[model samples]
Target: MSTLSHDERASLADALSRVLARQYGFASGRRQNLAIAPEQLPPIWSTLSELGLHAVMVSPDFGGFGGGADEIQLVQRQFGRSLLVAPWFQVAICAHAVARAGSPTQQGALLPPLSDGRAVMVLADRDAVELDAEPKVTQAHDTARGWRLEGRKTAVLHAGLATHYLVPAVTPNGGTGLFVVDSSAVGIGCHLSRLVDGSWSGDLRFESVDAQPLEGLSLQHHGEVYRSTEALAIAGVTADALGACEAALEMTVQHLRTRKQFGQSLGDYQALRHRVAEMYIELEQVKSACDLAAEAVEGVDSVQPTRGTAQALLVMSQSATWILQQAIQLHGGMGMTDEVAVGHCYRRMLVLNARWGDTREALARLRGDGMTKEMPGVAGS
Candidate 1:
């Protein structure tokens, strides 16, 4: 029996298929890993919004279609297949974090713009210890106007382009909590860099930057909500990896059928055929893991706060790397060159592997629960 209803699956399929149809010029970019700049994402993202693709993570009360296990994993896989350059991946992480932890007022403030794809937010909680979930290194002090934060975050995904940042900090009373800071705050400073996949990340400094407390993010809910956000992030990355693996496999199969070797099509090689079959099996398993993680998040179980996001990511890291490697090796020398989209798929998967959390980091989540869990947004202090 399936956890998702027919309508949920069908709706996502229809929307994503339409998105694939409307998205042209995606494959021909050749050497261009990022097809559009961050600023240029609005028009394309707006089109996705029209298709109701961006509204999947938020509830209908928050100006979204609904939140379930169905759409996000499916859509993210498709995004991976096309090697999408938009900040949709990061944006989805921030959006769902808010959905899980925000107050009604905060949701009212953030979700509509997010659901329609007009706003962007990034989480800035990683500090000296990258995997810590409860941020204690970033200190928040009550100010005359609001709050002032002082700390630094490294490799904040899409920090340069995001208008707002969800920053977790230690309250003066010693409670750990989350706060919302404007990217344009006076004391904030950001030095940006491009990742291998053409997405932007930043090394950020907050020298007493003015911020508003995300008022409703109470202590009782902090750990679970943080774990939930980490799960959503994992789901997005795993979904991407799955999609890229699928594309790489398909691309490899096509290359095998058309390319000639030793007076025979590469597909005629028994060894290579066996490798492809093994890869297909790995891809199906990876896909199943991603789907299950998504379902777990929607189901909201206690023991699995990250909804198996960490487990899914670990599975993806191994499977995606193996599949992409096979794709590259199967394609011969052409795989090493940017002239082929297959190379792009490999690079994108590598980039995803290193970002947020990788296989080792994911394994830490399985090491233990609570503060010991290896998840994004932890304050390993």
Candidate 2:
């Protein structure tokens, strides 16, 4: 979408589809919780890196595929298709931050290893919700050895698995600065926890953490990075929601065809059919909005991103909730159990809605950006 030529889009989609088909099956197994000791992640990480997942997100200057928001959305949709469990989302997003802010020397040192999956990364921000909020916890100070970072960030995705973290902190001069810190640093501590979708995140505390600042980093680019990253995130999750909704719809359709009640199949009932049709209509609407949002975020240099991503999240989250709810209701009791597909889809929807902001928070953001509505809900990472 946006400035991407039709050929670029088609080639990218075709490549991703072919490479992910096998990994997609593995992801499905993980989502279903069918495998014992399913935590083996090195192979999964190696596969994604080898397939050029990280390369696709990186800039061409850094030996990357030079992709942007469109690529982020398409690949994320595939991840959503299988609920793929990997640290790739964090790695690509953090690497993007480095490419945008790091000096040439830093970029050359960092980007290649990440491209080949030899390193893992994640991003940590203090105020992930409000664009206007200043960092209260993490701050940096001048030190003879370099810069010393001190603060805490909770709910960091892939905190334990990452080899390094891209942390945004408030400088003593009242400006936000981005820095890279080794995960093995002495003063850094991490408290692990599980998310609703069965993924891991951590609460990190930094005490006198020595870090490498991105040379030539500017204040304007700091905000831009956050906005850009959030846009990419929304795009990725939108694709994921599309995949989950599609899968759930398929499951519901299959059930309707086979399950009989009142001596007739559910497909033979008019009311259920109407509900299914309504679900399909909403899914189509969300699918369209997500595509436009990805396009807008891709051209974020010119497009107003807050409005587009907020609008997309609002539409997708609403439709996802309703669609998954209908899928569960139609499937009856078994839909509530982990033995079925729709149940996992429901969990994923819950996690996605909770990410950043849900439907209500999205509407509030849209309103704050000059759209009309009453305000409500809080923001989080």
Candidate 3:
């Protein structure tokens, strides 16, 4: 259940919508600037901080709202509609992990800066961490001085903008351990690249890099932490993709109503109307799946969160692809151009689908988990 009342949720969503409308529209070069040089977006980030969005998921002990998955869904939905590129994965995943499991010292040092937008911390692991995949390159060694991390993490989300990295490594004991590495540390190397949706990612290399563990967590418990954190991350992006799907459907519908062929608007065509109806059905399913996943993340009372989240992503990946493909097909040749909003929406959805675990892998992960009859969003449920 949501901590905020219905009115408050509406008010928050309206505020976010107004701000993005005023300052963050995808008008030609502005979209290009936001995608290519997000570092130049300090003003927008500052505005979001002042609105207390960064503090939404942070713990109240560190002067935050201590909100749950509902708040994350609300904020991310607005950003997704506008296709705003920010380091939100950092807040949604890394900071949540620290707040949920960090020692008092770690929380005190990290959460305040994060709440005020002074710092951004990203998760550095393999592309498939949602499946509990072991790190292929990074390893951690313990010494009297502390933990030292070696090896590299590739395709790190928002890595170029991060102040720190929450990295998972294979420890000498063969258990997975989480560590915090300062991006400016001496042994670190970062190479940035532009993704298909015009967002930035980094290939990060660490050579004998100094690091700090989230205190009080033994290696035995890190696996649980990793799974929950990654699950929440999936829920976050699913909400974002839901918003994009909504906008894409709306845009395509509008195009169909207006664009005429053979002296008749495209909407007059029976076959095209049928396609729109199918897209709407797919969208409703996506909405259901996304909501179920968010609720699962909030409760986290059982392994349901993991199974439910993977199931939700799979539903979203399949449904959203159909919605966007139909949106593009209905838009005809115009949809293929970057100027069309649906084209951008398609690219963003593609990235979100593949970012964690894609449909095939998520289905495999769900194959053996007994379905919870109570949560219909999960596979086989």
Considering every candidate listed, which one attains the maximal lDDT? 3
What is the C-alpha lDDT profile of model 2 across 1-381, one tens digit per residue? 233466977876777666666655644556533342223354466667666777877777777876677777777777776666677877877777788778899999898888877788788764322356533457778888889888778668767788898887767665566789999998998887767666777778889999988875664456556566667777878888998898789889999999998899999999999999999999997797688678657655434665788888888888888999999999999999866768878888887776556888788778774221111111111
> lDDT of each model, Cα atoms only?
0.72, 0.74, 0.77
TM-score of 3: 0.90
Residue 318 of model 1, lDDT score: 81
lDDT of 1 at 168: 68
- Best-first order by TM-score: 3, 1, 2
Worst 10 residues of 2 by lDDT: 372-381
Model 2 collision count? 0
Assess candidate 1 and give its lDDT.
0.72
Question: What TM-score does candidate 2 get on C-alpha atoms?
Answer: 0.86
| TM per candidate | 0.88, 0.86, 0.90
lDDT of 1 by residue, 1-381 (tens): 223467877877776766664663455432233555543453456677877766777777877766545556777888888777667666676777777678889989998888888787878767645454453367788888778988877778777678889876767665556777888889988888778766777878889899876556665456556656666677777788888888889899999999997899989989999999999999988888787677667644366745366677778888888889889999989898866878878888878876666677777766754333222333331
Model 1 misses residue 141 by how many Å?
2.4
The true-versus-predicted C-alpha distance at residue 367 of model 1, in Å, is 2.2
Ranking by lDDT: 3, 2, 1
